[model samples]
Target: MATYDAALVLLVDSSEAVLLQHRDDQGLVSPNQWSLPGGHVELGETPEQAAHRELFRETGLTTSELRALWSGPWPYEAASRIR
Candidate 1:
């Protein structure tokens, strides 16, 4: 079994609208889909680091503040590689 760690950011506006990504149709993974902003945790990086990195890389937004929500083992299958 292979274990992969990841991080996600649930960006919400003042009106409580959550920001999501409309994945590009040309992508190899979940193409043309709506999802949260995040990606896998890279080497030597914590989940929080990965989360912030992914958020900026995908949405070009930056936040100087972030509260820890949750962190634990997730029951995700790596073979399917669902983002």
Candidate 2:
């Protein structure tokens, strides 16, 4: 089986509501759907590093603080669904 790595961030407000983005309608997958900020990990980078990079790139937000909650392989079906 093949495998890959990805990173994501869950930003929450004082109200405990999660921060979400409405994907551009022009996005290739799940367009217009609301989701957190994230993307695939790049070579020589850790998931947390990728999460920070993606968060800034996608949302123009940056942070030096991060706490990993978990790590694991993505389901084959879901991974395959993405490009």
Candidate 3:
């Protein structure tokens, strides 16, 4: 059996362009590719909280309005495009 982890994909749209980050080569899933801002969901932490933390850490952007678009037990790897 494998330990599964939760994650959230952070997105921002200010009536302009969306954000995206590139994942470094890791010899796993997507490498040196593109993905949205996201990361592992913390214990006892809501998906929104996780997204809030990731968005700043990954993109250095903050917003008063935080929303979750999607989430699941997907084994996402490495840093990818943040949109």
Candidate 4:
């Protein structure tokens, strides 16, 4: 089993529209797909910190307000089996 920590940010607008980014076709993961702005948590960084960092790095946007919607170890083995 392998464990990886990651974080993602969901940005909503006043019109109730959500923001998403298209991954580069040449990218390593989920190429040419729409995804929320986020990435893996860096060393010595909390998930919240990583979320903020990833949001800024990917979208050039920053916010002081962020709330966790979910946090836990997702059952990777079961998820992989579904795919």
Candidate 5:
């Protein structure tokens, strides 16, 4: 069993429009797909920290306010890897 930790940010504007990023077509994962601004959580970092880092790294936007929508295991099985 392998566990991969990740964090994502749901950015909403005053107009209730949400922000999303288009993944690179040649990217290794989820190529050319729309996604929230986020990435894997680094060692020694909390999910909140990773969310802030990924949001700025991907969108150049920063915010001090964040609310967690969900947290738990997301299980998936492919080949012999479980996550």
Candidate 6:
């Protein structure tokens, strides 16, 4: 079977911005980010579903609408801002 996964979009607005979660260069996998809500896939749940869940779970908000977009890498740096 194909590998499954999940992600989010964090329907942010004026107050909030596309949140970027990354660790410092404290280790090997300690530096990365992206501009959108995201997460991992779960059982009995689509990637979009997982993303929505993650959006609320991580940021604490709801999206009036959610859509499955593209696939790529997280585009963020150490000194970046969303809002």
How well does candidate 6 score on lDDT at residue 38? 55
Model 1 per-residue lDDT tens digits across residues 2-82: 456768898888999999999999865467999888777777988888889989999999987766587654445562454
Please, what is the TM-score per model?
0.77, 0.77, 0.67, 0.81, 0.81, 0.51
On TM-score, the stronger of 2 and 5 is 5
Clash count for each candidate, listed in order shown: 0, 0, 11, 0, 0, 6
Error of 3 at 19 (Å): 0.7
Question: Candidate 2 — which residues are off by over 4 angstroms?
Answer: 1-3, 75-83
* Model 5 TM-score (2 dp): 0.81
3-30 per-residue lDDT for model 4 (tens digits): 4566889999999999999999986556
Model 5: lDDT equals 0.77
Error of 1 at 76 (Å): 6.2
Return whichever of 4 and 6 wins on TM-score: 4
Once fitted onto the true fold, the runs of candidate 5 whose alpha carbons sit more than 4 angstroms away are: 73-83
lDDT of 3 at 15: 75
Worst 10 residues of 4 by lDDT: 74-83
Model 2 steric clash pairs: none
Q: Candidate 5, residues 1-80: lDDT per residue as tens digits?
A: 43467788999999999999999998544679999988767779888988999899999999999887866443323312
Error of 5 at 25 (Å): 1.0
RMSD to the hidden true structure, all candidates: 3.0, 2.9, 5.5, 5.0, 3.5, 8.7
Q: Model 6 TM-score? A: 0.51
Per-residue lDDT of model 6, residues 12-62, tens digit only: 568876566554454222335433545555668777777778778766877
- Better structure of 2 and 6 per lDDT: 2
* Two-way lDDT contest, 3 vs 4, winner: 4
Residue 55, model 4: lDDT of 95
